[model samples]
Target: MTQDTSTRTHCPYCALQCAMHLQPGDDGTLTARPADFPTNRGGLCRKGWTSAEVLTVPDRLTRPLMRKDRNADLVEVDWDTALDHIAERLLTLRAESGPDTVSVFGSGGLTNEKSYTLGKFARLALGTSQIDYNGRFCMSSAAAGSVKAFGLDRGMPFPLTDVGTSEVVLLAGANPAETMPPMMGHLSAPTLIVIDPRRSATAQAALAGGGMHLAPRPGTDLALALGLLHAAHIGGHTDHDYVAARTTDFDRAWEHAAAWWPEHTEQVTGVPATQIRAAADLLGRAAAHRSAYILTGRGTEQHSKGTDTVSAWINLALALGLPGRQGSGYGCITGQGNGQGGREHGQKADQLPGYRKIDDPAARAHVAGVWGVDPDTLPGPGRSAFELLDALGDGGGPRAMLLFGSNPAVSAPDADHVRARIASLDFLVAADFVLSETAAMADVVLPTTQWAEESGTMTNLEGRILRRNRATAPPEGVRTDLEILSALATRLGQPAQRFPTDPDTVLAELGRASSGGAADYSGATPQRLDDGEALYWPVRAGSAPTPRLFLDSFAHPDGRARFQAVEHRPPAEDTDPDYPLLATTGRLMGHYQSGAQTRRVDELTAAEPDAYVEVHPDTAARAGLAHGQWARLTSRRGHTRARVRLTPTARLDTVFVPFHYAGEQAANNLTNPALDPTSRMPEFKVAAVRLEPDPAP
Candidate 1:
């Protein structure tokens, strides 16, 4: 493809942000080809190659829609009518109740400019403190843990290229093989130690590569982490000099892990004691050579004690002197396309631009100055994502909401209850490229431009700011999200200049707003990004981008990392005789979150048409379940049915299900909503379940 015919952009799916070229054909067709980039190295996953198909799906929404009443069907309408009605309803709700009665919900897939604007509009136009995004459910536990340990949170402190030079890589609850096939190229040279409940493809790859795989029981990763630390201490692998010089509270943290001996941890986690010791030895040896990395994913950080679980692993990393080293550090494998940037901007309930605490007077003043508003005019921190959703339409809760780019109906835990709460809202407005499950329930739905149709910037997993160039024009009836937000702000009596539709102008304003904060993007201009500059943030104006962090000192005031005193705990709900099995949820190779876009693609749907329960053969036999037969998995929250697929790779006491399907097949239907106190992340990794066979007709 010639440069004139192809537009350089990143994939629209996961955080890897694999670079690709969108080439337009003579017949008005678009195709995706892998482009050379550091993260993916000229390789594309199946999802990335087929992503263009979603742009032309049959059900793609091309017109604004509105419903006269809750019981009525949504009818096509003009953009002016839809925006005018939505703005009027929002004003009425705010005037009748209060500004706090209106809320805004955002998504992780939004571009940096859009995420920044959504947060600003929620505070300035709607004058509401209730704003959060789906990203709170993605990696909040890891973000919280990282902040507690290092005083800052970036998904990866170093570039992805560092992984190739590591002697050993321990994946705690992460599976790159299926979720991000392109990332597997980096792991081929490392001694892979995979820790997961299921023998995922990553674990299989680890064993086949002469590495190790530790299959712990569901929600028992904290114990396993503590065991590794204890073994490291007893094995004379603790880096005493590094701990004394660069860290604080080490003694207190070590006290928490001292009691978790290998034997005891093995008993709790269902892994062999010998294997636990061996894994510890490998990590310690590799770290001593300064050639090891520890990375975590959703499996270990989706429990009621998720923050502590992540802290336990961080403690182990610190004991081995991992973080802040050249090739050795602890990081989180962020899942969403812009998950790192989505939370860093202002979408989170408790944050302002640049990952600044909204409650901080200085942060508020700085951002308010950029918006030309008084600092006190901005509301204080509001409820988190789940809390915000749970309180909808209740007394003293938000009555009206504006949602963008998210579908919580099929993705949220205790989904039936979330849907009920959504239904109870007095008014709801959704902006999307298609009629998603959540959008289907909205009083007004605004058709918006999607990935290739919009030009913007996204911060990838490595914190690098990359530009997404518009490859083709959007349908005439649809508008960009920025235009939708800008029009609503104008209708709310705000000047057009206050909320710009041009991405370049918004990004410049965002730079000013984020100038002095932790995730500073002051130097990431549209011109610089489009000029092919690889800018990673905390980029102050007139300064170079920061690629790696914490070489000589941590972000804390004392220039030292702090160790969190974390201990192991049982899951929110333990198994009983009535519910003797544990059910866990995860992603499939063919689909993305909530299955909104990928499900619309014929190839993706054909590869995985429906969700299925992965059960161990022994467990299946005990439950009288046979392969290909329908099984009803019931939990305290609700039940979902799926065809059984018996495999020896599954843990004997645990069952696994992909969480991409909707309605009866949704894995989230059986998940618990018990939340972590610190991060407020729900227990999506484990739920007590009972299985019964129901043969399909």
Candidate 2:
């Protein structure tokens, strides 16, 4: 065999983003070896180790394929023809049905530069108001609350390293050990508290470390958050000085939160009064000089009350004087690689490039100047993800959809409903390396390069923008997502004049969009990121790109923070005899989201090949269940059959399922579509379900 000299790049399996050295063997085989990096410490997850094999999958789309009819097979087309048709159809859709009649969906998995470039196309060339991404179902809710309270959405506030000096860390929503292992090393603290509906790996670790784990009823996390903060207030834990100096409307916030005093919260949240007090006491018992961190993940974000629930967490953090401090505060743990970047770059329906609202006149002017377009030419903000799709099936809806790596059919809330909406569209195009569950239903499939074959930048959860290098060339025909999008925009006749042709140029443009805008990044060039220099957002001359945000003042107009004063709302789905159990979905250690790419790999597949519904041993016993037995998990939205395994992690009446499976086992199939009003995130974590024995597979 001959030695291979493939370029080295970062793994696409998880947000850990471990760098990899890919060597293509003489027989056209790709081999991946981990690069010694600070983040992964030269360690690779099962999924990362075998990610290279996904490139050689026999079923990979080798060329652009256009389907002439719903019942027809895909016909291969060259790049020019394929791109032209895609652009033409999109323009036609917009001209006839209006920009809102078509929607653009991006994925968090794309490289930061690709992510940035795609948004540029969507907003400029397309002129579509119905633009959103899969993140609306993952981490937006936590973001909404953090932004409202702390002026930024930081996963750990400072960085993963900041958690190293902490004494007690409250693990809300996130399960790092199983989902993001690199986070575990940094968050290894003396006391780790976990609050989730299911006993996830993080929750279990918290319990094992002799810390408290609060398993509230589904959709009642907001209620529990209120209870805990109210307890803090009742126990004289309110930060009166900070509140008075840096915030307004405290009186109103306190009034609303006071209603959730211990007794009332106990009834609504199902968390015991004593437990709530005990948890607060542990926090209160911490040394005044020591660090305490409150971090939330999807568990808190994917609900109708997601914003309110996260607001409750923020209220607790502010009440405890955590925000704007070194040792304590609330932070949102984002799940996507560019979850922070994707939204910041005008991809969100209502957002511009720098966390500014498109509807805001000043923000519009700044961005329009950067993009060389008129601010008044842009349409007003569009519908969020959940609202966008529901309207697709309505009378006056988008006739076309262009999905970029987002598999809403499997990953979106109410997958069954989303699939129908996709089917309803007259023209659907999917640009992805793999034929995802959603892409399988598309009218056209455009093969695009993956992370390993794309050279760009990615902004991590901490807002650190780093360079991502291409380690290997894509298959002969596959093109970068940005390249395809650009060509298609040109083909559609809405030529994006002056659009940057390379990722570096795109970043430069993105930085320009940030100048004089909220979360400015005018000086954040790709060369700086490539040189191991990451300038956090709000970059300006002599500013040093604020490493720690809100240290001096909040971003609000009055230079102060505002409390959400949120209250609890019941989970849309409730337990009943017909649906007597609760189902919670999440990621596992060996795999990334949906497992579209991960499960295809040999090593990762060997670790966890199929899905299982985890039930409490007691609940399983009563239901006459045994481990590894098939169980039918039914919910109000829908149900799927999976093997049942008894695990102590789940509380009684609640079962757990991993969302990695495609086909019938995708857990999002049963998730509720109801959304948080402010953030537009759906309830993906919890819903009512019932379990019954299945005869056989």
Candidate 3:
């Protein structure tokens, strides 16, 4: 009898990183089953259950392809030939233009090891300061807000289980009911206060649980949060003693909130003043008892004023003395699988490993020492994600680029412009398991192994470091991302020993480089993870893991959380005569970001085959549109078409569309690229758009 072959791993979808077990069948097929884990608790969503299908998708790329010439079709080539050609072009570009002329674009889906290696490769091998990732669009606002308020940024400072013990869970612009079904288990025990313009599934769940749902106008979350703060203060819910002892700058924050009041906020947000007072009362009461939590998601964090918007929410949490408490605090619901870790390990534009700023001399010396290079040899911080994309192939911008694991052509805000910029690149390279939209435009496309074929660590939404083991061998002619980076590093004249392809070795080096930094991981060795140890970050060698941060004191030198004095502002593009309605984009239950992987799965595609916009009946009637009819939504940036579905759950002045499908149906085509001044996050959650009936047959 043959022995059963199975391996334990995690899902490749969202930030929850639900644990799963993969078993190989006799007929060369694989199946995924939920495994007992802290985050998912042995439950898997449809996307998680069918994740194995992506590994064996029919159109999976297994060989290297290169464009022989400009305006030529891509042809299959050997690994050496592809690498040699890419190296030659990169060297020429660097010598003729400058190292800054070549850029690297990473993704949030990459494992910690890959993210670290990619960052190191961009700095050491390519000698370029231009490096950033799609994570900038995911939770940069929340990250910035958290760092400003608490002196550090972790998606969740506490374990996912903490929600179960909370009396109130205020979800600001977060919809876990559809995006992460398994997470709803934790929400079941807490009274939810959901804030969103549309009466989403999460809002419905809140109502079912006898909780409140505040449907504010799109991009007015900052005002709503300020009103909540004002009401909480007026009701004597402020923990005055706690604030005085554990926080600072409250006077300024209070002054700003004092002017908002409930009435004024109601006018801006369109949420009833009475509802604002009630919601504030619930949160204040819960926090007074030390059983409340506040959380923000992409909807509130993807705006032109996204950082300030998040700061407004953080100020409210701090006013109630939420941070540093055991059961009560503020957190962000990270979207991508490794979004938290990806930023910490140096894939971001302005960060080094361990979440250290690239511009810091001490951080440079520490990471440089680990790499056995001079600190001065490292480049300084460069442009952010959107800035990098917008500058591609332009004068004084990056002329060549190396991209991995991101489909910016579909996922980027103002995607039509991004596609044109990608097309303008003098040279481009992309590494992926399949030919994604961005990869299809590459001068060289290198096929890389999928998640199940690689063993690495991914930091989940709760900041817990989890290990995913290799379940099966990769297809022939394909390589792991580590191997690809290692080969490229060697081709670029870097020592082979510096770019080790082994995940374990790279992780150890990463720990060494991250030692003494903010996100210290020196103690999280491969052996500890193999021993089934649940490790969180900042785990110094010979010390215990920190499951919850700020339990006693914050990370700042004064050991006090800071209250940011922020004000609400209109979105980058407000409604006008040309565009009378607001359009917001989000994920669907069956389709993940960009739908590059999930769309290939037969079951998921069957469930949500096409992109559709949700419109209120009144709004549809006013626009002379009928339910299930295709409509054209036009914005200042561009336009897209989607079948309209009339539902009362939608606000009369707003429309909702799922941003998964690509091509003409992609919602991102209409998204604005106006960036948050601080986080550089595009205003994806709110856009001025006009809907009209499509006359096309």
Candidate 4:
């Protein structure tokens, strides 16, 4: 009775999660059309248009595969055999080593239901505290910063639609122009301020006529933000009345920013004093008018000082009295598809499903009550992502790992090291639709259904939960991740009542688990999402959706935000005689993270076939490098080879590389694993490197 029917779902890519409709072709293929959802509003990015191609890729894993012996090739195996083998190994590993010897790694792309189940399975079933997700690399800094300031983290306190009505939009280190093209429409503000090291597409647009682009030196965003605050203070642009009434510790914040005047900030950041003054003036005008927003992206948040950098920006917003005002505030531009929701559902190391602290006895009891477990049995928080990976096979670290949905071999910082560590594990398992680079090294790889083949829910960047309905049946032999987790948990002696495979059943439990927490989702249900428009979180049952936060008061106990005094700090690695240039990593418009899924699509790969480095003309000349010539980029840790593209967009002392490829072209090979203390986010945005020409015979 299956006919070519059209189903509505959101894009499987970024946090924008643009809505789209899918129609099945006679050849069992699918095509997409823009859905009239409020977020994207019938707009589709290139990745969205070509997303369907992955569903039919020839190499899509359709059966469970296992490597019986170490160094042996993975052979196709039946589901029962694969599950039994993995369960036996896990139990044996636990019996030999303690439960702490086993760990679980998740992804930001997992749905709320999947994330909830994964976290519960790790704690309740596996009885391990070592569980975290790829989101550790994405927005952990922003989350940490927001929690320190407003006592909560929700990506954007207000919805995306608010951007179009704002009088000014200060976009720091975010290039949505290429990453989320459709988002450009929301940049309808009269003035757009873009802060970045290069003349990114978004910066170029701002430079054209929209507003201004402050091209600060790498690792100097903190200085620039502090300089702006200083300028506002000296120029009498701060809203003293509002600051005094709604914020605390303003005197310390002001003193910290006062140390970095325009002249001093210019010297440290490499941005002219005049530009800083102009940006401060524009921001001042916007604040006075009560219509502006300050947004942060990976460029500002992926660093050793990421939390401090975000805090610096938050201090500036508080000085101008922005956060709690209507149509005026600060937010983080989340990158991954479920980056907002994934963290809320408890996949993070120190958090529960409600975004509550894992160490909080009250939170532990609440979640334990929902899971029917004793509160004292829940384990304590574990190590962060990189630390967890680096501990693999160590003297007293995790010996067996269960990884799902992420391809750390290409996406993780110091990816070469991560891949080697993963290879050194006693046992590694990966569940993914494609045989990604990480999966290729696993002892067991489970074939799982992807976006259109699964029924679940994802929270967009706006904190709105949208349904991802099953459009068509998954290919034979492939199963849902929920099903895989269910089978494995049961095989591990867990009762069926605990690990349910049905999405709705898991969601019902999640709703109760997340109730009364920061990211409350008790109001949203599968039936509601299917019948009505997407609803934002914190919507308790019978309550309306909360599209805008902090409208009247902040999340703090006293209804006031805090202003932390943060000073500029040096990057983890600085350029020196050995590594005379800086290397920053990012993404391209054509390829998504790690290129695991997008690389399989013919169109996307054809558009960006190989990885390349962006070098400044002056830097290229000094190195005797030409455009399109292969070059070796050597960092303190390791080196990588990429084709060099000379352009003035790059600063002379810095080089840019896209972290999407694996093998010799992997940019993460040169990235620094130094992490931010507060957020544990690695300094993926900046690393010291040296470029040398490779003589291609």
Per-residue lDDT over 426-450 for candidate 1, one digit per residue giving the tens place of the 0 to 100 score? 9999999888999999999999998
Query: Which residue window of length 10 is worst by lDDT in model 4?
Result: 388-397
* Residue-wise C-alpha lDDT for candidate 4, range 48-100, written one tens digit per residue: 99999889999999999999888899999999999999999999999998788
Rank order (by lDDT, best first): 3, 1, 4, 2
Q: Report the C-alpha displacement of residue 392, candidate 2, in angstroms.
A: 1.9
lDDT of all predictions: 0.93, 0.77, 0.93, 0.89
Clashing pairs in 2: 7-471, 8-471, 87-492, 101-398
What candidate 4 gets wrong by more than 4 Å, as runs, is 1-4, 695-697
Give per-residue CA lDDT, model 3, range 1-697, as digits (tens): 9775789999998999999999998877789999999889999999999999999999999999999986999899999999999999999999998899899999999999999999999999999999999999998999999999999999899988988899999999899999999999999999999999989999999999999999999989999999999999998999999899999999999889999889999999999999999999999999998999999999889999999989999998988988888999999999999999999998998999999999999999999999999999999999999999999985348999999999999999999999999999999999988888889899999999999998999999998888989999899999999999999999999999999999999999999999998898899898999998889988888889898999889999999999998988888889998999999999889999999999999999999998999999999998999999999999999989899899987888999999999998999999999999999999999999999998777
lDDT of 2 by residue, 413-462 (tens): 78788788888888888998778887888888999887766788776777
- Per-residue error (Å), model 1, residue 221: 0.7
As for candidate 4, its clashing pairs are none
Report the poorest 10 consecutive residues by lDDT, candidate 2. Answer: 281-290
- Give the Cα-based TM-score of candidate 4 against the true structure: 0.98
Candidate 1 residue spans exceeding 4 A from truth? 1-4, 695-697
Indicate whether candidate 2 or candidate 3 has the larger TM-score.
Answer: 3
